[model samples]
Target chain A: MILIGEDLNVMSGEISRVIKEREPGPIQQCVAAQTKNGMDYLDVNVGPVKKDPEGTMEWLINTVQEVTDLPLCLDTTNPLAMEAGLKFCKSKALLNSASGATESMETMLPLAAKYSADVVLSVINDAGLPSDADERAASIMESAAVANELGIANENIWVDPVLLPIGVDQRQVTSYLEFIQMLQDLLPGAKSTCGLSNLSYGAPKELKSLLNRTFLVMIGRYGQHSAIVSGFDRELIRLIRGEVPEMVELIYRAMDEENMDISALPQKELEYVKTVQVLMGKSLYSHSWLEV
Target chain B: MMKYEPPLEKISVNIRETVVGHGEKALKIGGENTLPFHFFEGSLPNPPGLALEILDTEPENWAPSVLEPFEDVVSDPVKWAKKCVEVFGAEMLCLRLLSADPMGKNGSAEEAAEITKIVADAVDVPLIVWGTDMEEKDAQVLTQVARACSGKNLLLAPLVKGNYEEIAKAAMEHGHAIVAQASMDANLTKELNIALCKFFPPEKIVIDPTASALGYGLEYTFSIIEEIKQFGLADKDKMMQMPILCDFGGDCWRTKEAKENREQGILWEAITGITFILAGANLLILRHPEALKLIKEMVV
Candidate 1:
């Protein structure tokens, strides 16, 4: 039931400086806000700052740990950075990845194997990504088999069937769910997860967090553990499921088709948002922007 | 002075469900209700099969045109297959271990066997496991897979001329179907089919005359298929009677027809449509779901 955020990664310019300058202020602020907002873990990724990666990782770990006892999810494609971050953690942490590919399996598994880390194994390998649900399931099975063979218990492995942003592909969420169900069937007790924010990453601001939480709940019903999100707003957590189809379609169009503006569809949006409020029990504010 | 004879009594070839002599599932590839190419309104029974393409690497450099739509799939093959079945309604699935190619991942036999098992258990449908395009390597890789899925009805495919002898022998010992690939030549196809049936038997084989697109080399491919059917109907050679397989989507997508060719690219879709039908391909492997649907409707 713990929610983690994947946004703290230094994949961008601003967060990179914040980590290297040892500016715990912005990060400390992030820690306090995210902790207060009820995030269970803040994924810390410095995006390959080798010159002083360990130093940077130590500072963020110390700063974030100082604020709360919440666990940390180590985020980095670099094995050494992940090692440095894990070295500094106070509590048992989750490894962001240890996928099925030769390189990823080779680089990431030892860390998880050595640390007894609960990790995300992308159902993927050198064969590249699949565009549909069955291949995603195959990737999950492939990953699970790899993990099981490496002596990782089924419970310790979480499969990520990469969710495409709905704005770009509507079947993104559906395909992900299908894979999740297959994992449950194949491994029976395997953990399933995806960063919630990735579901609506490139879109209107308000739509991002709101859609994030919604995606979290849908996949959560099928046993989604640990989504990546940015807020703890009440509207975000009211469990809005009723108007899901409508809101999802609208946002999908806005992001993918650019066909109809929400303002043009007033009666439809209001009636739909009300259904979401009723189903999820979240009190919602319907600005005219969501009208379509 | 040849005497005229009545049309050879049309009869169905029994496609038996063959369990791998070594593994967990069963192999199935033959069930002919009539002579090969006698589509004179006879029921083909089983729907055309689809093989899900898997790359040997992360597919970082896939052709941008084809890669864009399948971006979701390439990132994860298992999920992609599930979507193909649930959403696209695929009949039979092909697991191409493209990554196991020696040049690419140089993937090992053990790795291919492991992946094959995962995909086999992920769905209940029969599988056609392909070698990663290398003779000895494919034989080694598919040998483990064929043994592992022992008793499971799966087909280990693309056993070409040079490679066919060894792979076909393994497939026979392990109880799997062999896809005899030919270079779009009726005579070569007949020769190869005879060579394969000499050891594996016609009932345990399918024929791949080597798919070619509408504009590229499809005309030659079509002639080969038509000729194969003509031999089956007229001369009645038992070896050439194996069901024909076509990698239609792979060929179509690879050629200029399926892609966008603005200048002088006339009859793209229509030509692609006619190629498979004319070849009398029993199981046509296709990529686009829309195209598959259209073809399925046409066949029905």
Candidate 2:
């Protein structure tokens, strides 16, 4: 999994406050924390809170660059702010989105091409999120064609099927997974990605990581190229890699049924899960903290 | 010209970095994103540790070539172990309880523990107490040895399927680690890991997929380690994430190449150790100092 840190957006009050005050302290700390956690790229979203979106984007980019050299994922609907971030980015930036909408393609595609940046293209047109995999595939192909015409290489294009909150309509997961599978086959050279947490929106905050990680494992098997996720989720990446035997059972359960009843899992898998928990509970060693 | 980068997905699961021994003697291993020494894309956090083997009982049946390097210390394991650490710069010592084998002396567990306590007290370096392949004897002997040297954090060996529970409980109780051994099958290796983890912490587990000699089924061992590494990193199989061990000294020294001549024997051991290092073995056990010296140079 290519983990893109989702922390630097203005949606977080602390980040918004720092951005508004032009405070570099919290901004630097956020970048440092995420990079230390192994962020491949950090998403910089100067949301609608910034009265001066363009300047805020530049400040965020510059502030982050001072501490780490991780590529910035320039995230904004505002083309001017996106370009400002691109201008300030010290390395190749991933343009956080382009959509099938005429205005989006006309402005965002050219900037992505001009800057030689990878672009995340959502399959949403004026009609909004596609209702089915076929519609999603059609929309992605259309936007991808525009990107191709602009000299933006297909491999550099990351297509998102625009996830809907699964808690709202549990069936959305089937559609989403199908759409990803379709994108892999139909969109030959383009890569696939998702804002992993978006699928868990409207769910209880505590259960969000579980939902996102479970869904991530599914998409990972379907071959998601990358994901914009909480980079600090060591367990999530571990689960995605199928490393944790206990969490791996969650994947097996999720695959077994739509409702995913753990109690109903086969005897062998349930026994395996129990064994993992028992092993994890034991302390392996004791070390004195005073010694370096 | 535009080139196609093969979209080789980089492994997201960082191999859990763990240290053996404590303070200055601690050796860190297994923190790579790519396979061993693929430093351009990943990091090899620590070099593979080398341990010199010392036996509890003298080997009268040993090939003369295998015995040449240990001519001085072969009679006294304590002296042999000390020479390996003080004279040869061995980072660790592997105390093989060969006398406890049913076909050999079949010594009681208490006797092995007595010898283990002596070695443990004498050496400041970490110890790897390897057992006879006999499961019942290993379980009995290792239990006593682990309890005798409770806090030393020695790496105990050959935790086979039938005896893992008995041995692992002892390991957890005494704060030592166990080398979970499996046949050349990756699935069997994972099963043993999953089974041992039922009673032991994953951090205290090291894997041994049953080392093979250079000319005899080394490829099978190679494929198994490769699959194990892929599962640990690519699939994020936590049970499979433990560092791998190559018990090279016994297998290499027992081969036909060792029977032929001294140089061929040393070369055989060196080649086997180097092959395992490249194939992702984190702890390599060897008998000859020459093979150890050559392997150390190639490992880094």
Question: Using DockQ as the measure, which candidate wins?
Answer: 2
lDDT of 2 by residue, B151-227 (tens): 88888998998999998999889888779898776656766777776668888888999889688789888887987
- Candidate 1 TM-score to native: 0.45
Show where candidate 1 strays beyond 4 Å: A232-234, A238-292, B1-300
What value does DockQ give for candidate 2? 0.01
- How well does candidate 2 score on lDDT at residue B63? 71
Among all windows of 10 consecutive residues in model 2 chain B, the one with the lowest summed lDDT is B14-23
Candidate 1 falls in which docking quality class?
Answer: incorrect
TM-score of chain B of 1: 0.80
True contacts kept of each: 0.00, 0.00
Q: In terms of docking quality, how is candidate 2 classified?
A: incorrect
Question: What lDDT does candidate 1 reach at residue A154?
Answer: 84
